[model samples]
Target: MDSASVPFAALDYIIFGVYLFIIIGLGLWVSREKEGRQKDSSDYFLASKSLPFWAIGSSLIASNISAEQFIGMSGSGFRVGLAIASYEWMAAVTLLVIAYFFLPIYLEKEIFTMPQFLEQRYDGRVRMLLAIFWLLVYVFVNLTSVLYMGGLSMNIIMGLPLWGSIAGLALFATAYSLYGGLKAVAWTDVVQVVVLVGGGLLTTWVALDAYGGSSTGPVGGLTQLMGDASNRFNMILFEGELMYQNDEGVTQDAYQLLPGLSVLFGGLWVANLFYWGCNQYIIQRALAAKNLQEAKRGLAFAAYLKLLLPLIVVVPGIVAFALDAPIQRGDEAYPWLLGQYVGTGFRGLAFAALVAAIVSSLASMMNSASTIFTMDLYRNYVEEEVSESKLVRIGRIVALACIVVATLVAPQLADLDQVFQYIQEYTGFVSPGVLAIFVMGLFWSKATPNAALVSAVLSIPLSAAFKFLTPEIAFLNRMLIVFFVSVALIVGISYVENRGETHPKAIDLDDVEHDSDPIFQVAAFGILGITAALYVIFW
Candidate 1:
């Protein structure tokens, strides 16, 4: 599967080049500082807290829908069918919850990073600990995984070497993000989202057209694909229903990944909430909103976008399976389709879309990692009265260092069969406990800092013990156990330490009134209703 084997024409290269130029130009132009006013830490990190609803919304989706969704989740679609879409569909509901419940608290406090919120609620020690944890996850897990998947896609489709692809992506992301910071990442994301979605839809349409043959239109092609591969569209899987036999000669069930109806009601919620509400890279865009109403509107926009993702990512993989496309692995399904069906000009646009996904995510992650380090650790711990210019410089240095580290680690993940699932399974160890702590710290007035600290420390070990000790339980189910145990520890410790003293609330939820926005309320409820309807239809 060399580059020569793929149908990449001169037109495709020209299209890709044009796309790169336009995006880089746009990112720089939008993020440039005013003539006289140098960019302070506020401008560099939080987009000067001036982002409108549309930029916030588009940036949120661009930051989230990376190579993982494009390459890895599509691979899951190829292997496990529509059941894999629970991640996307369930996330819609999670976004709604974050918009209404979480945004009010965050905006009221006017925090730059999630760690800052922790410091306000608990203490500086807790904030520092979580800040370091987030930095490590962003560099190693988030940055490295996106690089690996993006490189892998380029290798399969364009015949580029993996290392070169990784290096190119790292440098490209750093070019604008390091200088312009989140403003560049967010505003450029507006265009990237459009290109990503449009190009993705083009790939799907072209692939379906090819599958249907010349005479049949896209509608007939879709109908034929559905009727022929009806089994692949089932959104639920029961135990003992074998999906595929692995290299170890063990037949794995679909329930192993999705775990039945629990996807709707159980541990998936913990994963989604932690990702949408608490995660730095995903939530940073929303945090930069000019107002709570704007942030809420942005999240609602993201929710609507989430609904359309399965069409671009999951449907293409299912179509590949329907055509019985030959490929070595499930992750190869997307690139394989692009090479096979997409024509010369369209192929370039599609490749640009993939690059858009990879680059936007890389920029977003780098900016967030920089934000946490500069704000949480350096400015607070090392230099209490750090100058704004010096802080911006430190952030750029940190962003570059993160990219270098992630590039070094990207190649190591090549052996993973499904990188998307790999990320989810490993992150589950911490997400559940972290979510538990946040939930209690926000709502439960009795939660002590010690209790929150203990839960954070124990989450990984508890999740690991369950993984190695009870190998048969699904990872999602294991997350539920970790969450409950962590919550119980927090509650028990808080009760003992507080000792009948009723402290003030950790977060003054009543201080900010977020319920007045009727349009936002209507949109939020609409999203919720749509989510419910989707589950019912899929179920």
Candidate 2:
């Protein structure tokens, strides 16, 4: 499965190069310290808490959707049809919950990282353990998969060498992000999201237009696609209802990846809640908001964007499937579409959009990984008396180091089939326990630090037993089982430790407002209504 290159015109390179210049310049400019102001840890790591709702929302999406969505999920679309969109659709719902529920707790504490929240909730040991879990997953799985998937797309679409593309992405991400920190990442994400959505929509239009023989618009093209591969348009897939060929050339069903009802009522919630609420890189933008209202609005904005995303990311894959695209594997669906449909002049912008998606996420991941390393690990254990300047510098150094490690390991992903699903299944081992720990810690006052530690320790073994022993259960259902077991462990342990009394360390949110704003409520309901309508129409 070697990537076949496409013809990239001189104009395309010019557009891409110009885009790179502008983005780098914008990031540096925004991250610069003002006159007479000293750059401190707050300024470097949390963007000085100056982000607006739009910036927060846009950066959240920018950080969350990378090569994983553009290449991997789109590839999933080619194979599994619209069922893959359950991830994005469900995430919209998750963001609302995160905004109304999780943001209140995080903002109340002024938390800098997810581990920091854990420390405040339980103890330093729980914080340190989760910190290590996050650092390893961020570098090994999240960053490496994005690097390889982005590099794979670059190779197939623009004719770049794989290793060169991967290295180039790292350097490009580090250029502005390492120096400017979250400030640079958030502001530049404002521009990047515009490019990402515009170019992404353009790419989707090109693909849909081509799918209709250049005769139909997006609506007509969608109709043509639905008519062509009717089986690929379902939102829910029953066992044996829909079959797709894996990278190994074996027939399989989407049930394994997205089990039918569990997608709605069970395990998908565990995945989305952890990703949107607990992931450091994704939630750091919301943490930088000036107020909780802005955070809610930002998440609401991101939810709307999430609602529209499947049209951009997933539909093109289905279009490829309907058009009988000559791709070797599912992941190549996107790059093959870019190389074939996106024309000479616009290809540069499309290519820039792809690079923007990759680099922005890479930058966000590096910054958050550094945030956790410096704040949770270094400040706690390495040096308690460090200066603000040293902490900021340590953050920068840590950011660069994570990027370096990810680059070195990313090429190993060449052996993977669908890197997105691979990431989800492995990250599942951590998500169930994490969600359980936080859920009990936040809502149940009787949850003890020791119980959290037990839940955290048992997550991997429990998930592993289910994965290996059951073998027949779908991964989503397996996560559901692991989540319940982890919760049971926390509950049983907490009762024995605290005797049903609220733990001394449990959060008391009596003073904090427990409700969302009226406007935010309106927007939240709108998002829900739209999502429900989409499911009904596509069901």
Candidate 3:
């Protein structure tokens, strides 16, 4: 390794070791089975349906924020600036929508996985097909990308070999999670979130203080950064507004990434909704909640966390940019900040926090991917009457298998510049179809099994078509086109096939309650108000 690389000092390793001990112990402590009972699918996959609002809230953010946010999004902040935070800010509003609209519907169905919901709304064929698609994407796209990005950060700051770091992260996540399942993943996440947030703010504060350059403290750093990097503070990117260097060091229009007002009005919603509501690992925490109210409250808590995330994830990247950080790539920005700015005594604690983010997310995805595979595919098709204990065993096995596969695949992502944007673009290929099927099934009574099935099948190819055929169209815009087309196809086919009649399998939207107490109302409105104010200020 080059002398320029700042390897973790002895104090740093000691802090990280303590963090691992506490988290692993916590995960194992809660995962212990009740005195005489053997493990069941609910216990293994859904945390015994015993999670409270606080645990759910913490796990949702833990699962959602990871190398993707800390490393990849920070890299985005370095490349295109605060416009990348559109993902974070818009997600706060989307969480409320998910809480109000989506959570109740899923809870009422009493389902274990998203694929099972598909079976109830459509058919077994749809369920099986989508289950396979979800597994492939979770392992190949989501899980591997996180591992690659997390390793990239570790390599930069800790002076570890990239492949070894990827393997180490996989092993660390597997240690606590394989034995305990969702119960372990979720409860440990409560602790993980604390470490993750504390560590992030410390990093941001120090970086900002350094950026201030003796003018004042962190506040001065902020004022100076704002004044000097005025262009980096923009929330929207119109055509010809700005050009910035990507990971490859190629300058490009920021509009290609942010895509202007579409962030508020168009396909970004499709991505956020699918991620927050429809995606398995993310929503699995909500599924584990004790009741709908608890889940809603958990989502509310997460919404507030989302509002504050840019400070931790984005601001440091901007600080790095204003400082003209000498990094090899965009994803290296956060690690560079750590090596260059973060102090010795605290570096271990900060590094621990980053590890907390990575492993918590890794554990969550492995659990969810296994849930879909074992429940939807294995239990249903492989062995129809498998014992509950056996099902739990299968889940553990599948989770291990998925992690193993991801460990093998993650290193290949080294070529991508801005792994966060890469994940969004590629995941968009599948999101349009996933969103269309769920939205139509939930709200429209006439949506046919055939229509939903066709839309699900076409989501990716159509996205790829728009991507290759019309390269000039920004990906966010392409996703909008694919979504509209999917919706239109669903409508036309449903009307033609079902002859304007309600499908028998349609969710009774009226029966799915929208009732919320005053507390939920205040929280929801608070989220909306904050979101609006942010846009007004940032715009």
* Estimated TM-score for each candidate: 0.97, 0.98, 0.99
The sequence of per-residue lDDT tens digits that candidate 1 reaches over residues 1-539 is 56323857999999999999998998889877668988998899899999999999899999999899999988888877778888998898889889878889988888999999999999888899889989988998999999999998899888888999999999999987888999999999999999999999999889888888879977778878878877767676777663764324456787878888779888899899999999999889888999888999999899889988998999898888887777766778898888888899999999999999999999999999999999999989999999999999999999999999999999999877778888999889889889988998887888888989999999899999999999899999999989999999999998899974544547766676676788777887888787778777766
Off by over 4 Å in 1: 1-7, 246-250
Candidate 2 lDDT over residue span 266-326, tens digit each: 8999999989989999999999999888989999999999999998889988888887888
lDDT of 3 by residue, 313-421 (tens): 9999898888888877888889889888888868988888889999999999999999999999998888999999899899989999999999999999998888999
Which candidate, 1 or 2, would have the higher lDDT against the true structure? 2
Which scores higher on TM-score, 1 or 2? 2
Ranking by TM-score: 3, 2, 1
Q: Where does model 2 exceed 4 Å of error?
A: 1-3
* Residue 476 alpha-carbon offset, candidate 1, angstroms: 0.6
Write out the backbone clash pairs for model 1: none
